[model samples]
Target: MSARTVLLPALAVLLLFALAGSLLIGPAGLSTPEALLGLFGSERGPAARVMREIRLPRSLLGAMIGASLGLAGAALQGYLRNPLAEPGLIGVSGAAALGAVLTLYTGLSAAFSLALPLGGIAGAMAAVVLVQLLAGREAGTITLILAGVAVTAFAAALTSLALNLAPSPFAALEIVFWLLGSLSDRSMEHVWLAAPFMVLGWLLLASTGRALDALTLGEEAASSLGFRLPAIRLRLVLGTAFCVGAATAVAGAIGFVGLVVPHLLRPLVGHRPGALLPASALGGAVLLLLADLVVRAIPTAQELKLGVVTALIGAPFFFALVLRTRRETA
Candidate 1:
């Protein structure tokens, strides 16, 4: 059997295992069979309530959010031809967070819960447009990354400023929880709110795999091969904005899944950016589910934030990547 076939199935299985663990490994301490029964069977009580209300939504969100991040990461890395591109690095996540925070600060979220994701979507779209404008079409990879860094810093400053000047203590608290990134107390309402946007984003991104493959040959060559650069760029930008924005709206600005998952799966896909997308998505789902599970399993007064665990793991890997790239260049 080919490696791609084997690797893809293995990743899928890993994701399933992680999903099962996420459902079964919560504080309820239900066994696998009991959890499954609670999830699917007509059993009334705490097990069913926990299964339907808590674990299900959390697990679903983890998988969807991770997939969105991973897919966006692969798409960006493929199109930009850069190994270091991600939503957080490029300011998209920060902008999305700012939008969600705006809803909270303005009391829109309190009045209308759906307003939160909508605001985040708007913020993410604005960031995408801004980033594209900052990084001109002919810009080099270094130039693009620099623009991303500038935008990221600006958005982060704005977010911090919002937190500092929040209208009420509750607003500040909301911002703090969001900035840390947790899936605690999430509901099926969140699942319903974010799923449509996430699904649309996945479709748009998945459509670009062939275009990304053509892009590896350079813009001129890709154009000559009948790929419209404008359409591809729009798809990637809008798609990423929708996915990441919805993710941030529901779960806050969880970072590093996009950056780490694609990087790890790249080699396994034979370094083909096109082939790496699905692998990264599945790998990301696995990683996030596992991380969420670990956070729940740990004994602490308060659960560790999902983003904190990912950062603790991802920051070291990012540093290693930078060092390796520097060594290779040197």
Candidate 2:
């Protein structure tokens, strides 16, 4: 059997295990049988309520968001032909966060919860459009990345400014911690809000796998092979925008999952961008679910921020990657 066939199933199994682990671990600490009953039973009791209302949504969102990020990362890296490319590198997440922050500061979310994700989608679309404009039609990878950096910095500054000028202390504090990201207190509404966009993104990104594979030989070669570069780029940009935007709207700005998952799983998938897409998605879900489980398991007074945990793990890995790249260049 091929490594792709074996690895894909293994990753799927790992994701399922992590999801089961996510359902079992929580503040209430239900037993396995009890958790199962609560999850599947028709009862409206406390355990069922907890299971149906909270943990289920959280687990689903974690999987969806992680998959989106991972897949987006893979798509971006493949399209841009740069190993370091990721969704956040292009300001999609940052702009989406800014949109959510605007909704919060303006009290639009209080009026309507759906407004938050809508705002995020708008921000994300706008940012992508602006980046595209800045990069121009014929721009290269470096130009595109530089444009993204500029947009990211601007969006981040605006987010900070909103926090600084927050109407209340509690609001500021909430925004501060939220920027660190978490899956806590999430509900089915959040799952409903973000899942559609994330799934759409997955579809868009997944369909580009063959084109990305072709482009590995270079744009001219891929064009010669009958792949339309413009369509491929459009799908890549829109896919990342939708996935990262909705994710930030619901879960705030969780980072590193995208950047780490594809890099880790690439070799296992024989370094084929097409094969790496699904592998990265599953790996991302497993990694994020495990991280969420870790935060719940830790006996701290307050659960650690999901972003904090990821950064602590990812930063070192990032540094190691940098060193490796440096050595190769040397």
Candidate 3:
């Protein structure tokens, strides 16, 4: 009956159709209509394997990674009260990439699949700790952004240096892909590999929903309302690092899902932090699944990376925000 009421449901329906298209449209298109029937067990075809093994897991992983990125981004933005805040900008992705790079390039992942995620989690944890030490309890927005910039720059530099110093061709290629982010040929092993950690990370982040809402006014106001600032800070940091780390372990460095999804869905959820989290997650899953489908459909002969597509879409959007801010300040 009204603008606010009509728009959200319309957007939701569109997102659902996009998701269905993602499951159906690909380089090897699934029977889709039949597969939808098969989902209800009314039909059978060659699509069963394609849908079950490849599309299903890829869709699931895309959803997982997208949700993780979206939640992390929303958490950072709410925690810092800055619209520009994203996990990648704050060194989470770089730290996670660095960790995975070390394990995979050093030949450790060959011996142990868990090594990749473990290394990423460790690197992310270390970076966050350093950020806490430098920024401290009295940090303002300027301090928070500055600390994140410094850590991200340092982690990126170190990652480049390691790639340059790599001992072999395999190491170099692995580093390149780690930075680019892909979902190609990813199997059930990867599904299981990152799922538990991703789920755990989501829980940790979701726990901070109330804290983020409390932070809207000011630290003093939030503290007066019985929110523990220190505990809030800890959960935000650990949850972001763990989830981002685990995601990079499997998906490499997919960008912009965190940056794009929350900003897009914030209005739909009435700007409520808890509602923002779930709305962003569903939106993110849909976004990444579609992007992965594009990567598959494009006739590159060689597959395109997921990050490349998302960054191309997101980079201009970010610059537009920057310009909008400058105009507003003026």
Off by over 4 Å in 3: 1-16, 33-48, 112-114, 133-147
- The local lDDT score (0 to 100) that residue 91 gets in candidate 2 is 79
Question: By lDDT, is 2 or 3 better?
Answer: 2
Identify the superior model by lDDT, candidate 1 or candidate 2.
2
Residue-wise C-alpha lDDT for candidate 2, range 1-330, written one tens digit per residue: 977789989999999999999999898988988899999998888999989999999999988988888999988888888778888988789999898888888889789877877888888988889888887776266777888899899999999899999999999987788788889888899898888888888999999999989989988898899988877777887889989888888888888899999999988888899988999989889999998888888889878989888888889989999999999999
Q: Count the backbone clashes (under 3 Å) in each candidate.
A: 0, 0, 0
Tell me the TM-score of each prediction against the true structure: 0.92, 0.96, 0.86
Ten-residue stretch with the least lDDT total in model 1 = 138-147
Error of 1 at 257 (Å): 0.9
* Window of ten residues with lowest summed lDDT in model 2: 135-144
Residue 14, model 2: Cα distance from true site in angstroms = 0.4
Q: Flag the better candidate by lDDT, 1 or 3.
A: 1
Candidate number with greatest TM-score: 2
How much is 275 displaced in model 3, in angstroms? 3.4
Model 1, runs deviating above 4 Å: 132-151, 168-170
Full-model lDDT for every candidate: 0.85, 0.88, 0.77
Residues 1-330 of candidate 1: C-alpha lDDT, one tens digit per residue: 988779999998899989988888988888888888999999797889999999999999999999999999988899888777785665678888888888888888889767877788778878888878887775355555676678778888888888899988877987898778888888899999899999998999999999899888987898899988877876787788888888987888888899889988998899888999899888888988988988998989978999999899899999999899999999
Candidate 3, pairs of clashing residues = none
- Candidate 1: C-alpha lDDT: 0.85
